[model samples]
Target: MFLVLQLAIIVLSFIAHEHEAIAAYVPDYSSLVFPIHKHTDAAKPLYSVEIMTAYVNMQYLHANFLIDVDAPFIWHDCIVQWNIYPGSCPPDKLCTSPVSCDEYQCTDVRTSYSYQKPYCSPPKNESISPGWGYCSCSVNVVDPVTGSCGQAKLNYWDDFTVNVSNGKNVLTGVYGVYPYAACAPSSAFQSFPANVTGVMALSSSPYALPAHLLEPLENVIGLCLPSTLSTSGVLFYGNSPYYLLPQKDVDVRSYLSYTPLIKHPDSFGYFIDVNNIVIKKRSISIPANATTKISTLDPYAILRTDIYNRVIRRFSMVTKRIPPAKPVPPFGLCFSTQSGLRVPDIDFSLPEGKKWTMSAANSIKQVTKDVACLALVDGGATSEPAIVIGSFQMEDNFLVFDLENSTFGFSSSLLRKQTSCSNFNFTLVES
Candidate 1:
């Protein structure tokens, strides 16, 4: 018994030593702190500086900020409808035709370019309208719901309030107030007895209504940063320039000079860059295996979407073990398993009703997964295969990634501030 106890003591001693070693070598996670500050640049007009934190795994960023969904507030008393299955091709419109004449399987294409759509015969193909009906999903933009819908809609505004978890004190009196006439038609409106939760005024100076982070799918009345200042360009619907003014302080009459930024305008996708914002691109180095094809990748570029041709999160960690030997995915190829890197985008449609209810259908869901980042094991020999990560839904926009415990986080670089800050670059190895 004495011998056994002695042996146990020796094992315990070793474990203690290991723990101490780990404590010493574990990267000071505190060093990874994100810097959020109040900006008072009237020329730039930025009221806040939301500095994104750097992480070993980019997934954390996506799960926390990018993939966030904003629930539309109840446009009190507003009545809205959507057209889900706006049927087939219209008359005078040419449909796809397969051509055997081409060496490869080819789809013969015709559009306004190839065929001039003539006036259709009355009552012909009446089921097919000249234009697709706009899809409308109910938004709780003012009085929000318990959960936002996931399925896509052509037109909708999800009511969302910023969740100031870590630093509510910084935004002492921030308040979110929209013009009553903003959502006119009045029939489709909703009013929640509760006031906006994350509302605050950077300063109670009462310049006008402060700009809210416009919902991705909403018809943005205006953008309110602390001011018009932008470190990076503000993204909008049509990639067109839009004016930024405090919503509370400005008048809609002045907006007549500038075109309102429309979401999903007659076309599908486009990018909007705000004026005066200096957007810098961040380049992170990824590892290439011995057989990695460097030529296939844009060696200097960092966008996973641009290089890999898919929406994904990139992670780089320094592990004690070599990454499992595998063929990195081919550049510009989509993953078959529907997994690679996933960058989260805001889905403002999630429901967050009156209470802190988790059971609601639109409750915040935090989705996370163990994703792989670009690595350079042997200076470009092979690429890594996509891994199936996990996801979770949270009640608010803030996401937590516990890298110290080995689980990872996810995020996209889309909303990150571009900078010459090289600390954003990383290298991976076995822990």
Candidate 2:
């Protein structure tokens, strides 16, 4: 759930100029070629994959981060838990580097009034007096698990060594070292899933992680979220190609269909042009230019009150014959598995006349052995962005946010294509 203040950024166009502009930044980038050398030649035969990529990987300007996760529905964005280096200096010896209150980065982050604010600050006299006063930069960080926003210190992260995966059953290396992240208080994490250190933000803001995709990488982020928790999903940065093992080395980028990415003058989130919605064969008409945006925070697809009621009501009617099960907490409608019935797929009709269908795997949630519910939620009437496509519906789908081209590309579902987002090599490969 988003604050009403940020929602105003979506509603009132004139008020946008009053705050720091969240422009869709475009960066010029050179083409990167990661060639898995088909052959190493007869004389100096080596690993079929190029050593150039391995050599170039360490010598590159900005390290490319390859993030993977098990549970996607409950977790959103690039989540990380940094392991502080042994010798990085910490002023207070707490192994933390707090940004100065007057630093430019602090000032810029302080202007993020919509999401974060100066929760606690000293008086003007003391804060400005370099000799007698000291104040740490404070900002708000959002917790996805509990949907709570809490005050956090904006600080520089002396990144720790982490594993980088270059496709399944192929390789692993300690390659990435990122800088800067919000440090949430330990109390804030009490409600979080155990061991979740921080959320590596992917929003389009200068202070976020996506801004680092400049030097050797393109302003492109490809995300493949897994459906089940048993396996892992992958994240790609820059111009890197995608290939899942056991299914031949096929780049999944070719399967994506493009849609124009809409720019919101006041927000750091990504928006898209969705014409309407279709359930089964019936079409549900929504306004053409509804404030529709995508989100990693929301647990399920949240529709504006009226729109949600219509969709869920219509769905119930179609399956009225099957007795409804006891009301689930988050889900409105559910039925017993004994009914031996199936749910309808929801189609998001885009402007290009192409519909992105959400199959049962994406639309329905199996809560218990006998209870399966329609995985949808109601965003009280007048919710900004009439439709917020949450992570639940994004599972197993490959999405590319091509910021440079102002386009959004999506692959409906990896399963239907005879693959999975959990392109994980579950079995022991003789690598």
Per-residue alpha-carbon lDDT of model 2 for 95-131, expressed as tens digits? 4455667788777766652353244342121222245
Local lDDT at 152 for model 1 = 14
The TM-score between candidate 1 and the true structure equals 0.19
In model 1, where is the ten-residue run with the lowest total lDDT?
A: 290-299
Error of 1 at 366 (Å): 17
> Which numbered prediction scores highest in lDDT against the true structure?
2
Question: In model 2, how many backbone clashes occur?
Answer: 1
Off by over 4 Å in 1: 1-371, 374-431
Measured by TM-score, how close is model 2 to the native structure?
0.72
User: How many clashes in each candidate?
Assistant: 116, 1
Displacement of residue 86 (Cα, Å) in model 1 is 45
Query: RMSD in angstroms, candidate 1?
Result: 29.4
